[model samples]
Target: MKTGKLVIGIFSIVLSVIIGFQSMIAGLGNTLSENGEAGGSGGFILGILMLVAGIVSIVQRSHRGNAPVIMFVIGGLLGLILAGSYSDLYIWSTVSLVFGAIILIFNIRNKKIAQQ
Candidate 1:
């Protein structure tokens, strides 16, 4: 669990950094499309939420069971869904889904553990 959290946390941080960089390069006024359209900041909020969740998981190492792990899985799915446009988003989404699968498998293996 500790290892899984650490890996996911690091990946989340890297994703956040990449998104931040892209936002900076694109400028705050720039929209996802030339029509001045956007996803209404949901993507940005989700990225930050994932980063925080990862950090919390790392800090609360031993407490891993189901809920947090499930959150990671959901985050991964969200990433994949959001990846339709941004390249960095796609990369992170792929990474998250892969790592999330690994973590989910580990969680499933410990059947004796009760879900919180």
Candidate 2:
């Protein structure tokens, strides 16, 4: 469980970095476009949320409760919603969502093991 959390956390961080760079490139282009700035801003926000989720996952490696799980789920959903129009952003957002789902599964399995 700990290893799973660690791996996912690392993956999330790496994904965030990729998303950040991609978003900046996509967002900063054609400043004259009406939606360009909005998209870029959304992408940046998504990147920040991903970063926070990664840190939280790394710092809280225990299966103590649902806090971390909730955070992951929320972050993932928000990432999707705020992924902007970069198209590529959806890929990262989806990855983040998968990471969150994996963590949730880990938490559920851990709980079952504990109860047993």
lDDT of 2 by residue, 39-58 (tens): 55566666777778778888
Clashes within 3 Å, all models in order? 0, 0
* C-alpha lDDT of all candidate models, in order: 0.57, 0.72
Q: Number of the top candidate by TM-score? A: 2
Off by over 4 Å in 2: none
Q: Candidate 1 clashing pairs? A: none
What's the TM-score of each model vs. the native? 0.64, 0.82
